[model samples]
Target: MTTTLHVAIDSKTKKAVVFPLVFSGVILLLMMIFGVVMLLGQGKLIELNPNMFYKIMTIHGTGMIGVSALAGSCIIWYFLKQYVPLNTAVFRLNVYLFLVGVAMVLVGIFAYDFAGAWTFLYPLPAQSGGMWGKTGAALYLGGMLVIGTGFLILLLEAARAIIKQYGSLATSLGWPQILGKEKGFGPPPTVVASTMVCIVDIIALITGAALLSMSLINVFVPSFTIDPLLAKNLTYAFGHVFANSIIYMGVIVVYELLPRYTGRPWKSNKIFLIAWNMSTLFTLIVYPHHLLMDFVMPKWMIVMGQVLSYMNGLPVLVVTAFGALMIVYRSGIKWDVASSFLYLSMFGWVIGVVPAIIDATIVINHVMHNTKWVPGHFHIYMGLGACAMILGFMYYLTRLEGGRIDNKLDYLTLWLYILAFLGLTGSFLFSGKSSAPRRWAEHLPEWIPADMVAAFFGTFVTITFLLFLVRFISYSSNIGSKINQSDDIRPSTHG
Candidate 1:
């Protein structure tokens, strides 16, 4: 007789998440192709109208962030469910709202020709300079609100469930442990991470919803207005934090999988709890760094922004990465697709931090903040770090339940992906070093070569990602099939 086991994420929740993950994966492919097309246009290899370029750029940014968040939510929900009771219907509602909102956003962008970009930045939406009209702006902003409403409800529900189980958010955050009132390891890492995410994202989505509501009103009522500075502050505060939260949520997968893989429990100590708490605070405040370019902001706020940006991701990244290395060292863990990607996420996160720190400095930011350097910074972090964690979970799920087998091609594909992604980000950094301005529709001849190089690498990335999605889809059918019995609730040590 043979025995098979799956990760402890329950079967019903796995079935519930299938559509969202599939939707996320398919949309990711579409967005990547849009990214490559943008690179091609910038490279002079294709003829793309300037307006159309910005429009694609708009959807590219919005779609990527939205879907990544959607995918990241799946990871959080899948694991957190093991620790607490989460309503499957609430999770399903988020996907439904996401789809409806995406349709509205599409109509706004393609049908109505609205291309104000994801951040929109206040008056631009109202005063589009004839690039778009009120209806288009309203649809986009309103769609975002609807999507945010769903997430807000979902998060509130998570918080409710967490509080019900753990007594309170602070307890889940391990405040008692950090304060030394309680001893031993803190709450399970999933609880700590989920608590932090629920708190921060609830605040962020509300802030964004308010901003969207105001912007939506301003779209039709020409007399109504918001201070540009306030709008900028709100925009980055919401955008920066919401986007960064994807990685924070996705990292839960690492905390769970690594321990189970190496058979080393990832116990949360006092310091770990403190670090997560600090991250919660810092992530909320660090958006000021993006506004460092605007001198009108209070001097103290500018200083705080830069200071917080330096400290923003350090606490959590340091602990998590160090813990990962310690877990894998001498553990004799098997080298497989899921574990490999989980480990790679650590490298991506740490490396991504270096460039961000550089850009956060007042002097460097003054020089390089507007260059392709900024894009390069986030691409490494969000692309490699957050995306890797999600991909690891995807692969982990398929393998455990579907019995997906790994071949040399899978490893080969991974290698190609690493090198190719490095190649793409390298071109962006080089172009920035050469002083190429970001968000420009056209590039000069000197910059064209770098764009061409980036496009070449981008092509490979899209192809490789297609392979990843195909692999996931092929095995996705077996997801909830093999893990039905009550005994299957336990996690396998490794695949």
Candidate 2:
């Protein structure tokens, strides 16, 4: 008989992961506030510099993506620690490199006004007209390079740890079990989710790195221009995969934590394993939808994008959403800040997917491609879904050490956050229905009311997050203390 042991995550490692998670949460909050303010300026409610608006837009978009990815990494690392012993040194290194990259990006955007938006689409950075110089472009792209390096290293570390523990990637992803050849521990759902994301993101990062390198070269040698179509494809290919992975990261939180609240175990079954495996492949193939409006794109690629877009959401969203509902339906679960947010995020995921699928349709894409619908769909998923997952994980950690929170206040703030976000995204959808264009620094008089409504709801969101931050700081301090005091209490096991 063999007894398997579950190793404890190191206190130092927990500290490393927690600090970054909280810091990224703060960055995420700030980005949202700034984004809302920028939208207000676009509405012309407040006078703002057009260049400054784009500059803030650049930072807000990149910062939100970066912070979401960082938070997801932390969640994966912390949970992965339970199944496999991780190299703490490598984990810390990832943190240092990521923060350094973030700093460089902030300087490039704020100090020098690198306002090409997050995509840094081909020729835009180099041809900034007069708003930003070559150095700013170089700095921003370089920062992305650094950030990609950190994430690549992090995924590599995760792969190493998973393979070491499970013997092979096949086993880690439960392919053997899916094939009926093996009956191993079958890889927990979190392990399966993390493994899938690691593989996909590694590929995404490589694409990102290749493009950034080319962009940097062009920045210095203006004569060496790349193909705009090739650049756009690679850029969106990387960007779409990277953005999708953020939700997958959040999914692990649902897999690992939601069970605890519902007193159920989310194990690796055939459907679960198959769903994740499909996600890994479809996420890569769905980038073409972003290029549907580009007439130069190959017709076959556009069709592939539409087909894959429909397939990609099927496995994860349907399975996870249904699975979550089953767990909570009559489980007599305790609904706290952490569990409530986690559960509610699934609704965001599903609701957001409806619009995403609609937009992927070829006819719809022709009309709505550049409308506010794009932002509306994205914010619905990421703002409400991914952010909610990260915040829920943070709250879970703080309360892990037997820390108590005010139930009334937590529920109030959660509702406020949800309602405000719905309002904000609703405003976007309504405006988009009226053919409101996106990425405009100024809006027409007809669109003014929509922008103002979105901005108004955004304020409620800001207030809710402010309250969350206070509780986060207060309770997180207890986590550090609890680390020193308790060794047997694994909050991974819900009461």
Candidate 3:
């Protein structure tokens, strides 16, 4: 195999990279804005109808999830080009497909009331009103299918490149080949983990696409027995895995980028690798946990779900925490805005893991299965933890793109965001424990006046998010015009 020199970022690739980054940022901002508005209004603190609340929920979830997937793909694309021999033509095609797919999904969401949750479980879609609703569901599913297709193509291309470069999956999996001992140029851990993730995504895409297609067929074509159980299983199967994979990808960013700003080694310790592998394996099988509330599911399956859910915490606590700890107490610790944000992400993960662990229990699951606690736990885990990772990664990319970081401002804003987010969501969780239900627009019980707490917290969160929006916009606009070396406080030369 022939070796090549490192690729430099040029004007063309830079433009390509900036487009998706900007788009993703805009989408995320819009989601946050709409979310705040919806929460404030629907909680009866500001007064809004059920229809408006549902609409906002649909927009927020669709925008947030779609943007997240796009951001992940963009990150994969941007870094893959630096080392991997990606096919430019295929890459370009994938970008367009993703864009088109996202557009269709958005249009579908806006066309009708899709309060079926982002999961869009079957029978609910069937139970909804009129033809437009059905059509919207079709369009949404179609759009997701198209996006999955694009992801598959990208994965295939990456796999082909890996095979061409390193011979076979076996060779790539081997120690020498992966360690880059043969050529004196080791691939980053992100690249290796990315390859594995792509493979998993491909399988997920196929399974999800097939199930979605079956559902659509059952909708249009008569004489098709739409197995509700099968469809539900497939939907959750895809939803659970897909959602978890975002965190998996975020972990790569955490491991690869965080250490850069912290002046620490990117340690791919054996335990870390094992944890990662086990997490991935466990993710594929953990979908049953969502079905624990259902009676039709087997007793053993329900038990397995709880067991896996608890087991999932091991990798996160041991591997993720230990790795961060390695850098925390090291000599010459330098904390910049990006590093501060990264550290905060770990903190969010730590706080979230407790609620997540509690929710995994059969007893607690019985009480808080579909309550506000669910969103509360996930907001910390995925929103603060995964989303914070995305924010930090974007900050790193901004720096890489030659943006000057305002260390003081960034650090202050990071703390504000985290504190407000926790305060708001923590109140929501408290309400859930007090038997408050989720997705209610109005007529909340007089005894449960948690909306007051939520409203107060929401105000703080809104301001913090708005602050982030301003910082992001200003930084992006002035990215190429300044150089502040003070932000680069860490030792530049890695040992």
- TM for every model, in the order presented, reads 0.96, 0.95, 0.87
Which model scores highest in TM-score?
1
Candidate 3 global lDDT: 0.68
Write model 1 residue lDDT over 1-495, tens digit each, in one string: 122234566678888877798899999989999999999999999999999999999999999999999999999899999899999999999999999999999999999988999998898988999999988898899889988898898999999999999999999999889888988998999999999999999999999999999999888887889999999999988999899999999999999988776767899998889999999999999899989889999999999999989999899999999999998887767768888899999999999899999999999999999999988988889778988898888888877766677778788778788888889988999989888988887999999999999999999988888898888999887788764223232234433
Please estimate how well model 2 matches the true structure, expressed as its whole-model Cα lDDT.
Answer: 0.85
lDDT of 1 at 437: 88
- Expressed as tens digits, the lDDT of each residue in 155-241 for candidate 3 is 788778877877764444334533544543234556555665676677777888888787667557645657778788888778777
lDDT of 2 at 103: 88
lDDT (0 to 1) per candidate = 0.89, 0.85, 0.68
| Candidate 3 or 2, higher lDDT | 2
> Who wins the lDDT comparison?
1
lDDT of 2 at 362: 93
What tens-digit string does per-residue lDDT give for candidate 2 at 41-156? Answer: 96787998888888888998999999899999888888888888778788778788888988888899888889999999989989988889888898899999999999999899
State which candidate, 1 or 2, has the greater TM-score.
1
By lDDT: ranked, best first:
1, 2, 3
Top-down TM-score ranking = 1, 2, 3
